[model samples]
Target: MKKKDNVDLLLIEEMREEEPSWTDYDMDETSVKVQLTDTVFDMLLNDTISSLRRIETRLT
Candidate 1:
């Protein structure tokens, strides 16, 4: 399959929605400590690992 040079319009719109603004403040260490529960951390790690595996499979 051939790759397209240009990005899809839908993807551009989705990214525009997901992009963080300058006004967004960084979380404090204490806030992060409070929020990073084991279940949330585990889910985040699993999602990231799954995403990487999908990308690797596509590349190969």
Candidate 2:
């Protein structure tokens, strides 16, 4: 795999590890909203990254 792919995998792994922390009930409403927003952003970013990789593969 390419270095970019490796970096992507690492980022994914990090995100997975942080997933459980978002479930903690001690956070305030604002914090929860921010975390949820970050989660949604990360999901969209990963989707975009996958799409770009697919396009790159098709072109090469």
Candidate 3:
């Protein structure tokens, strides 16, 4: 077994940040925003996997 850092818990907190807050908007604005949002979401997913892997490795 290995040690883990608790700070990963904070980094895992999506709601703690303001950028991801849900909002109501016009479709035209939303359409443009969606592209940028998708890229951000993809990056988040990539980061989440790495964070999870680090924690998982620490448990083994």
The candidate that wins on lDDT is 2
Clashing pairs in 1: none
- For candidate 1, report its TM-score: 0.41
Better of 1 and 3 by lDDT: 3
- Please provide, for model 2 over 1-60, each residue's C-alpha lDDT reduced to its tens digit, 9 standing for 90 to 100: 699999999999999999989886766878989999999999999999999999999999
Question: Considering lDDT, where higher is better, how would the candidates rank from best to worst?
Answer: 2, 3, 1
Q: How high is each candidate's TM-score?
A: 0.41, 0.54, 0.46
User: How should the candidates be ordered by TM-score, best one leading?
Assistant: 2, 3, 1
Model 1 regions lying over 4 Å from their true place: 1-36
Q: Write the per-residue lDDT of candidate 3 for residues 10-56, one digit (tens) a residue.
A: 56665457454555457769898999999999999999999999999
- Shift in Å, residue 40, candidate 1: 0.1
Instruction: List runs of model 3 lying over 4 Å from the truth.
Output: 1-30
Candidate 2 accuracy as lDDT: 0.94
Q: How many residue pairs clash in each candidate?
A: 0, 0, 0
Among the numbered candidates, top TM-score falls to 2
Q: Residue 22 in candidate 1 has what lDDT? A: 37
lDDT (0 to 1) per candidate:
0.75, 0.94, 0.78
